[model samples]
Structure formats: C-alpha cells, structure tokens
Target: MLKPPYYPIIYVRGYAGTQEAVEDTVATPYMGFNLGSTKYRQTSAGKIEPYVFESPLIRLMKDHLYQDAFHDGQILPQGPVSPRSIWIFRYYDVVSKGLGNGERKEIEFHAEKLRQFILHVRSATGQDSNKDFRVYLVAHSMGGLVCRCYLQNKDIPDLEGKPPGDWKKKGVDKLFTYATPHGGIEFRKGFGWLEGLRDFLAINNADNFGKTRMREILSLEKNLPLHSLNNRFPAKRVFCLVGTNSQDYGISRKVVGPKSDGLVQIENAYVKESARAYTFRSHSGAYGIVNSESGYRNLERFLFGDIQVNVSLETLKIKMPGKEKNLSATYDIENNVSIRGLPIPVNKRTKDTFSSSFRSSDTLEEERTHLFTSFLLKTARLNKRRQSLGFSIHFRILPLYHQDKRFLPDRHYEGQAVFDDRLIIEVSKGGDSRFKVRYGWGSNNFKATKNLEFKVDKNNLSTAVIQLNQHRPVNMTAAIRFEVSAWN
Candidate 1:
C-alpha cells in the first residue's frame, strides 16, 4: 500500500558552471543532498555551538524510514521501491563531457528531462496509472527554476500543451526551495551596470537569471512578472527557505552586499506569495542554508506536518502620542520563532539582519502584517503520548521617530522598543480529533492558558486573537491573530 503526502521525494541540485563541474557533479551519488553541518550559532550574539545535523538525506532515513533509490552500487533497482523513497534528478549528466555528448542544454531542456524522470520513477515504483502517484520537489538555487519551469511551462510536445495540474492525482504535491533566486539574481554593489552587462552578454549563460530568459523558461507573458506563479500551482504548498547571512559567502559577498545570502538578495530569494522563512545562513558554504539545522527542520516540517499555523498582526490602530501622530516614523517588526526543545529558531526576521522592517504609516494603513507561517507535525512531538506541539515567537516592534526630516534624539531610546514579548502557543487534540489551542504571553505567564477563546469558521479554521495593550509604549489598539488548520 502507498501512503499519500509521504510520496517519493525528488531532489534537484543547483547549477554547475563548467563542463568539468558538470562531470564532477555526475560523479556524486546524492548530489549534495547528503551534506550536513556540525557548527551552528548558539545565541543571537554570535556564540558558536556544536550541533550535528546528519544531513536531510540521512535524517529522513533515520526518522521517517525513507530510503534512497539505489542498491548494491547501482542506481534504480529492478524491483518495486518504497513509496517513501528519495530520488535525485541528474539533469546535468547529459551535458557532462565525460557522461554525455558534452552539449550545454538550456534550463528548459532540463525541465523537459525532469518530466520524463518523474514518469520513470512512477513506473519503476510499480505505481499503475490508476493509482494516485505524487512526488515532492526539493530544489536549491537554479534547481528551483527548473522545477518552476516544469510546473509553469506546457509548450513541450510531451506535455501536449498541458502542464502539471491536479497535484494529488499526479505531479508535485509540494515544493521546498532553499535559497532560490526566484525573481533573479542581481549585484548589490555595482551601480546597475553589472546586471545590465551580465544580461547583455549572458555570461556563462547567467542570463538564465535575467528577466527575458526567465520569462521564456517559466512560460510567463510579457506583462507578467518573472516571480509570478500565475496560479499554475497552489502557492500555499510552496515553501521558500531564504538565507540572510551575506558575510560568510566568501568573496562573492562583497559584490552581493548586505540584505542578501552572500549571493541572492533576500527580496529576490523567494516567490511573491509562497510561505517563506528566513535564516541567517550563507548561500553555499560551511554556513550554507542547505546544510544547516534550520533548513532541515523547515524541510521536514513542510514535508510531513499535519497542522498549519499562520500568525499576523491582524489589526493595528496606532494612536501616536501628541505630534508623533502627524510625523511619519518607521517601525520595524522582528519575529524569532522556534519549536519546542529546538536549539535554533526555524524562522527568524530581525531589523539587524535587514530581513524584517516596515514604516509605521504603512503598517497602520494596511492594518495587517503577516509575520510567518509554520507547520507542526503530530509525530514530531517530544512526547508522542502528549499529541501536541509547542512553539514560541519573540515579537518585537521598534519605532524610529523623526520630525521635519531630522532625527529626534530626545524621543528615541537606544534599545527601547514599542513592544517586545514572546508569544507561546500550544496545539493539542481534544475530543473528536478537534484541535485545542492554548496561548500566553511568555513574559507575563509561566505557561500557556486555555482561557483564550478561538473563533471557528466553516472552513475548519480556528482563529485566536490576542490583544497587544499590555506592554506597548504607545496607546495602540492592536491584535495578533493566529489561524490554525489541519494539514497534510
């Protein structure tokens, strides 16, 4: 019997520039999927900690019993494979000088090959056409673009003008991308000249990251943006793991500059509407996002989680004191979230890292600012008997006040914040498999209390609203909303 959601996982690696690199990539068995890290940050102050993440590949096998599609020194065994199997899309092998005809193929060609690869996996896994077969596409960097191209394009003859649709019946059930430049990569230091030159010359086929080439590869119209998903796949099912550490990406970080993951800027590393989480890791290296603990946690949760939770500042009615109401001051919101018993935060966005910030005027006008989306798996609970998941969100709101285009030194404090607190949330199963949510402000309470009320809707979504009038600096009427739903 086959299990849904635990379907086969296909890993597509990033770009290999030269023919030698391609040959080297073909020589690898897992295509960097087996890489893990031993060093991690213990705190926000850059304290080093030693933690062993035995790579996503080994962890999946150890935790979820997921096996790789290889046996006895041979790739792809003859018999039927486990449903929870991992496959690598070796798209670069064809272009490798040692492996194939030594012809560099376009990303579109790789995507077309991916289509055939999926079919082969389906057949080799002994899945009949009548059976509902699905797979999860896990990609890094340019690999994500290839997956997107496969999902968004349909002009290929094999597709017959119909791209991947009906995700459950056939095709990718979900996509998890790590440090992918969905909107295309741009240089931060060069004054627009570097980007133009790269696009003009198409250096090393780097034009694949340019808008013109992206539009063709992703099958987007001239009017549509390159990052637009166009509703081809459900945006909610896509998870973008963005990296924010630019310092450790080697000499390339000098050109990419700040507010980036050493190469891809934070703003361009994700799709517009996809669920995103930011980690302070570099693009690729010892501190790379792919080999980090945060990245693996996100991938595991998104793949097998049974519950979905979204947190947002649902309403913000700020009554700025005195003259401050008329003045436009920028406000920065920081969210640091971590699951229970976890040493590192799965999602972190702080002003210091240039990942989370907004103007007070804009936040007031919008009235809603989504903080983050997280997944909770029942089987992942520390105590299986408890059947619950616990997490904490450190939410901080800082205000930068000014008047007449001049900074006000008298009103501003160095480390003071408009609001600073940690919100603790716990979700457990009550009667009839219905979820019971308990929440509390960590600074005020020792534990989560069930006294909070949740409003249930027809869509089976339960919402809990927490007012933010307890420890705020200003007279603000704001509420943080938590929306919870059952997920696969």
Candidate 2:
C-alpha cells in the first residue's frame, strides 16, 4: 500500500476578500475596489479587523474534514498521521488601508508571521523532530503573491537556506499556488484602468503600496530574475493551478474582448516557465482552488502523477496575398505548400506596376502586421491531454484583390475567412495514446475567387500527413493540387 503523505495542506486566501467572502466577492475587484473605503478602521492600539473573502478558506476546511470522515480507512501505514489543520492569517490593516506607502513593509511583516506560524505548527505537532515533515501551501489571488514573499524573502534564513542535511536526504516537498499572477496584472491597460485611477488617490496611497510600487514588486520581467519565489523553492515539487473563463462581470463583459475569468486574464494566470500549471476553474473562487475537489485532484495528480503535465505552443501560421505573377497561389496548412514562382514585375507600363508598387510601399508592412495580430487573436485549445479530443473555431480576413493608380485613387478588396479545427485522441487499451489533429480553412475571394480548404491529420505521437483542396469558380478554368508530409 502507498504510504500516507507526511504533511498537511495549508490554505491561503487572496486580496480584499477573506476566507469568508470568497463566494460573493470573487467576481468583483476586492482589493482594487475597496482600497481606502474605510476610515478610523486602523487604530494602532488594540486590533484592526480587515475585510476578507471567507468562502475559500471555509470551503477548504470543510472539504478536508469531509474527506477525513469519508476516507478514514484509506490511510496507509506511515510515520505520522492526523486530521489536517488550517490557520487563517488576517491583515486588516493592509486590506483596509491598501498597500499604501508601506506595502512592502506590511507584506514583510506578514511573511515573517507566516514563517513563525509554520515553525509553530511544526513544533506543536512534533513533526519537526521527525525531519521528514513536509508542508504544502495552496494560495489564491494576492495570497499566492504573499506566499511567494514568505518563501523567497532573503531575510528569512530558515526558508531561504537549504533544508537540513537529514531533511534533504529524506526529501521534503512544497506544493502551492493557484491563479496567482507570477506575471503582474496589466494594470496600465485593459480593465485595469480603475486600478490606475486608485493609484492617484492619496487616501488610497498609504506609501509605496501604490500601483507603481505594486508593479515594481510584481514585475515578472524584473523581480523574477532577481528574487524568483518559484526558483527559491524546489520547482520540481511545486504545483500551480491556474483559472480561465471567458465570461466577465456585467460591465466588464461588454468592454473586454475574447476571454477572461472576470478579473484575471487566462494568459496572466498561467506562468509558462513555472513548475506545473493546470486549470480546473476561473479566478474568482476567491483564491479557493485549493479547497475544491477538482483543485485537490489536480494537486494530487501533480504531486503523485506517474508523469507530469506539459503544455506548450504547438503551431502558428499566417496567410497573405501573393505577388502579381503568382495570382494563382494559395495558402494551405495540411500539405505544407506555399505559393512560389511568381514572376517579378518587370515593366512600368504593365499591370505588374500595381503589384510592384504595393510590395514596395508600406502596404506590405501593414499586411504583415495584420496577419500577426490575427494570429495573436486566435486562441488555442486548453488543457488538452495526450489522448483527449478538442476543437476551436475562429475568424480571419483574406485579401482578394487591390487596384492602385499613380496619382488618382487606390482600391482594395478583401474577403472573410473562417475555420474550425477538430482533434481526436486514439489510444490502445494498453498502449500509448496518439492525437490526430485536422483543420479546415475556407475563404471566398472574389467572383472568380475559389473556395479554398486545407486539412491535415497527424499522429501527435509520430508523423504528419497533409492535404489541400480548392473549389474553382464556375467561370474559372484553372485547377491546382497540393500535398506534403514532415516529421518532428
């Protein structure tokens, strides 16, 4: 039987909302909206109760307790075992006052407090004496950032230093983080406009905690290289679950384009270079990914899966108009065929002058930029497993014809391009699974413009086969065929 895990899980909540308000305030901008909203709430004398999202924490505790009751007999023979414990770390001052001028100081203090809490837990449970005790952290929203501060801070000798000689030999592991922006949020653009406005307010600006300061601390390009929390901890043992949902809040839904999990964009949630990132949800669970069953399952898989998950950019393509001589040229994805042999325009009096001028002018740059922007706008399949089925539909624009006169006027023609891709996963009962991807791109050019289609099916585990087809206009006489194959 497999030995039970040696350590318990620690849950951390995100910004503004506490473990209690997770459910209701998730879709809202908790921290960005509530900053400086309260006065006389932070008297230094006794205690300052801060506003927080409590749903995530409550859900986490309840889920674990439920699991313990339901699966009590599942525990294996091990060195140490008991019901898991959870401690909610509250910072009313930081939440109510915002990051303000002393944001870094406040965060540092909290990090130390968390460190002490961890040490205390280790001591109270007598697990520290065993030298085999492991602690796993799961944080959401800004909580993940706070956790990073704690783990990566250079001042914290115990955390920053290498594990004890005995513990190192025994192998201590850490797994934590969910929907945390390893790459800081795009506060300068998009819906982040409000956050920018808040940064200008004095009552909100307590100190360096303003938007600029937050940006400085969270800047992935800057701080990541200097004091990367993911690197500070063992990456192989770290686990992260990101969130993505296309739907946004009522107001944001109309403003933002494409997809987002309300507040955090999907791209921001998953740090490509991080240890392991998965998705079972959107960002608004108020940093409660650790508390959900799906979250726990993903966590368990990351910690114990026979193979780790790998996600990467698979393919990219762009289509553009061919030079004059190759007016018959077309774009195809399957057969790896590209337009070629377009005779260069030679004379100033011929129709070739238009094509030559178009290629020589800034039009080419504009076309290239348009193509690049279109590719970026396209979204790829998410969370596709080795043997899983997936599909995506997107739109593109194709240039059909253009007319230009030296001094008079220039005419332009374009057509709409639409396509859908389908993926199939084939796996033998006892063998490895292979993915078959097929895509079809169709476009209607001009009256004489043909309807073009391309298809490719590849054994993602092995080789690729491609094919192309075009339906000529009823009035057209020309016909073409293309086919190709390549190996990785």
Candidate 3:
C-alpha cells in the first residue's frame, strides 16, 4: 500500500558527440537509459571484487515496481497506461535532420515542447490533462540545462506578455542531474595545440560549440545569469551527482583537467547550497556516474526513500595544553556506509578520500553549517532480524594547508584517525503512526551507546553526533538537525 512518491519519470539524456551520434541515439529504443554497468566494489575486508549492476531501468523495476511504456518493440500502447511508467524525452530526434524533417530548433523550442509532452504523459497515464500530476526529472549533461531552461523562464516568447504555466506548480516533485555543468565548464586545464583547439571550439563565439549554442544556453559567456535555481522548484529538491574520474574520460579530459569528470568540472556540476554527492565516476562511459551502482543507489534513495542524516560538530572539546605556535590541524570525516543490501556506498563516497575536511579555525555557522549527507531509506530493504542499517564514521586528522608547521612532537600526529562504535539505525512499527525512526548513539566517553528515537509526526528528519577531541575520553555532544524530505 506504499504510494504518493510513486509517479511517472521523465529521463533526458546527455549531449551527443556528433550529428551521426545524434542519429544513432534516436535509433536506440531507450535513448541509452537501458545502459548497464559491470564494476568492482570495496568490501569491509578492504577487497575490490566484481559486481554487476543492471541499468537504472532494470533496478527501478526490481525495487520499486516501475515499468516502461513500450510494447512489441514499437511505440506506446493504445489503452491508458499506469502512472508508474518511465519515459524518455526523445529530444535528439528533433535535432537530427535525418530523424525529423530538415528543421533544427534551439533549446528554447525543446523547452516549450517538453511542457507539452508532460500534458501528453498525463493523458496517457489516465490522469486529467489539466489537473496537477507529479513526475520526477532525471537528466544528464546538457539535458540538465534544457530542464532548467524550461523550469526557469518562459521558454516560448509571449506575443501578448502572457506567462507560461508554472512547471514547479504543474508537479515537478524532484530533480536529479548526473554530471551537469550547472555553473558552466571550463577548458582551461591543459596546454598544446590540440588542447588549444578544444578550448577554441568550446570558447569560440561563432557557430562552434564552445561559444555558440552550448555557451549561450549555459550562460558560459561572462555575466549572463540563469534563473533555474532561483525560480520554480526549490534548491533542496535538486540533487547533483558529481563525477570526479577524469583520466578515463578520453578526449575531453585533455582540456577539462584532472579534477573533472571528463567534460564537466566538479566545481561546476552542482547548484550552490543544493544537495550534491561525489564519486570516482566519469561524465559518460561504461563507468559513468549515470550507469554505475553508486549512481543508481543515490538516485533511488533521493527519489523514493524517507529520512535524512545531517551531522556536524556543534562544539569542539580539543585544546592544546602547551603554548605552541606554527601548528594546524585538519579533520577528514569519512563514513563507511551500505544501504538496503546494495553493493555500493550509499553516499557514493570512496573508502579513502570521500569526505569533508575542516580547519581548526572553521567553527562558525558560515564555515561548518551543513549536513554530512542525506539518503533515502526504504522499509522493504529491511530484514526481519535487524530491520535497520549498519555504518561506521572515522575522523582522519591531517596537519597541512600552507601553514608554518616547522616544529612538531610526533610526525605521526599528521596522519592520526579515530574509529568508534558501529552505528545501527532503526525505524518504528506497529500502532506508532507518529513514529518514523528510532536509534541510539554515544556513551560516557569510552562507554557503549544510548537509544535515540525520532517520530514522523514531529517532522523527524535528520540526526548526528561527533567526537571532536583526539585526546582520551571523547565528548560526543554535537547538536545536528538535517533537512530531509520523505519520498515514500
């Protein structure tokens, strides 16, 4: 009887390499949405092993009971379809002259058409066309920009100054973009003739991609502004899945840099202050973020799960006994996580480097005010025995950051880490309808944990506790509240 968050999904694929590539994409039935991944996962034993992750389409069917709209290798069926159906915005067909009439339109045209397509989906799903109906938007690369253009401004130029329908009001419940350049990408990473040419193509003001359509659409040329994050949907509803594996990204990696996911820079992939998660995934490939298990796990949780876990340090108990100058400390917060029996890190962070670091001076709200991560937890994934999740948080303190640390007691202090009790999160059941989640954490410095339970009727969303001092007897008194939206 689980429902509400269950709605139709509209997927928008990334940019094509060539006009021929566009043609090839149009020829495909699912527009690459059916692509799967075969990769390795690092277990608690610290071993890399094999794991096969079917495409997002298959996972959705296996987990949430969703299905596609096609039948007999042809178009949609004649009768009304279920609300739990998936659809791809076949946008490239309009751009490919071979697929459509020899007419190619700008992104504005596509945005307007997308609004109309939602109406079509409502009618097809047996819902009232004019009434409100929710749908999740999952886009990749430039498709994310196209989604923004539609959601932000009036895509179609109004002849009589009439505003278009409010898409957010029309029911865009959640948005998830994979490797999208929300802040516009830069090709200023490398050198050489070919590298210069790549930058030239993307930065050129003429019909070339650098300075032409892509640049114009993304506001890459200087001070042009984009209203996508400010208008329509709220920032919290958008999830940016950032990719950080640049070496495997092929040609684009030449100009993008070692810190990018091939084409889009990690810094440019997310909206400011919005929810984002990072992984060692490329922009688009067999190991791409959109096709991998980590990516799928994040997408599923954000779209269909309930609960959010925001953690931070409200107070620091660490103090230097001696009056020592030229000293600094950095804490690398890492969480070892597994979600719903999925063979991937739920936050998509790595075992070694996937974490947020803080400086000794960064104690105010402007510097340290944010959640560690947020995830969707489903009741179906629970076993009869535990009915909860298992995880561990470790703090790796480092001493560096251009500070004058010439003298030190022990050099080993630069690489110190603290590991504590493994945590288990539990949810309430039975007649406790107001109850959503219940769990316990921490003890008297070196003691065991105490029970901490939360209720949904009170908007129980997120919780956290951290140990600040590296010395003996830790104080785990950090007040943390996370902003979480319940999906199912």
Each candidate's number of clashing pairs is: 0, 21, 3
The residue-by-residue lDDT of candidate 3 on 1-488, one tens digit each, is: 21468788999887776767778898897887889987777777999887788899888988888978776665444336778988888887877777686355666677667776666777778766434577888999878877776666444422122464554455567889999877665675344455446656642121223334554554343444332355455777788888878877778787777667887776678876567777778888877888877788788778876655544444433333245565444554444444546655555333343333444535532355343455646554556466444332332233232235457444325332432433444443336433344334434342224444443435554333433333533222334342333444
**Best-fitting candidate, measured by lDDT?**
1
Clashing pairs in 1: none
What TM-score does prediction 2 earn? Answer: 0.48
User: Which run of 10 residues does model 1 get worst, by summed lDDT?
Assistant: 154-163
Question: What's every prediction's RMSD, in angstroms?
Answer: 2.9, 16.1, 5.1
Candidate 2 has an lDDT of 0.37
Q: Is candidate 2 or candidate 3 better by lDDT?
A: 3
For 126-156, candidate 1 gives per-residue lDDT tens digits of 7756356788999999999999988877554
Candidate 1 vs candidate 2, TM-score winner: 1
Sorted by lDDT (best first), the order is: 1, 3, 2
**Cα lDDT listed for each candidate:** 0.82, 0.37, 0.61
Per-model TM-score on C-alpha atoms: 0.92, 0.48, 0.79
